[model samples]
Target: MQFKENQTIYLQIAERISDEILLGHYAIGARIPSVREYAALVEVNANTVMRSYEFLQTQGIIFNKRGIGFFVSPDAKHKIKEYRRNEFLKTELPRFFMQLYTLHIPMDEIDSMYREFINNLTSNPSNQES
Candidate 1:
């Protein structure tokens, strides 16, 4: 994953892992890759991946099992959704609204585009995958 200069790498990694969970790549109660394994996959240091895992653990998205490995929490999906929804509302929505206002774009146009986008998603199921 490409690291953004503005955000810390560990947080970005945490987000990526959250996304994987949402995508069903890691089902609830499923064991995730070890910190070292994931570090190799993303080509980052193991400490960075450990930090990401720690963040996720603090968020109750995942938990470590003694002598085993980390697994997704039962309510991880719901928690992820809640956090993302809040983040989008608090951060992304304001930026989006600003852009619309700055560009003098009408709600009607955005609604039409949104509808079209939804239609396309429904029409092409494959497009929904990463």
Candidate 2:
């Protein structure tokens, strides 16, 4: 729950929740903690957690139930994956390409390194946690 200076806290919170969902920690249609409860758990302001929840709701990742707390949307997994894939392509891929260009790294070298990295990841079960 460490806050990064580069992004807003609410966005970070939303990302964390999305990650949990992807990890199967939060199943589809499962109820999540209340805003105040999650704030307490993450040691943040309730309002901040509320903002995160609102963002998730707007993204169609979660829905609120009257008299009950929020539940994960039925298609949240698909939606989250699509959103994350697009986000990585839009933000991270550009930075990665820039780094490769600045370092004068060839595409073939990058491809080889990527393959090695993937092989290592697949060989090590613990590496999949992150």
Itemize residue pairs with steric clashes in candidate 2: none
Q: What is the C-alpha lDDT of each candidate?
A: 0.94, 0.93
lDDT of 1 by residue, 1-130 (tens): 7989998999999999999999999999999999999999999999999999998998899999987989999999988888889889999999999999999999999999999999999899999855
Best by lDDT: 1
Q: Taking the tens digit of each residue's C-alpha lDDT, what string does model 2 give over 1-130? A: 6889999999999999998999988888999999999999899999999999999998899999988999999999988988889899999999999999999999999899989999999999899754
The Cα error of candidate 2 at residue 35, in Å, is 1.4
TM-score, per-candidate, Cα-based: 0.74, 0.81
lDDT of 1 at 66: 85
- At residue 87, give the lDDT of candidate 2: 91
Runs in model 1 lying further than 4 Å from the true structure: 4-6, 106-130
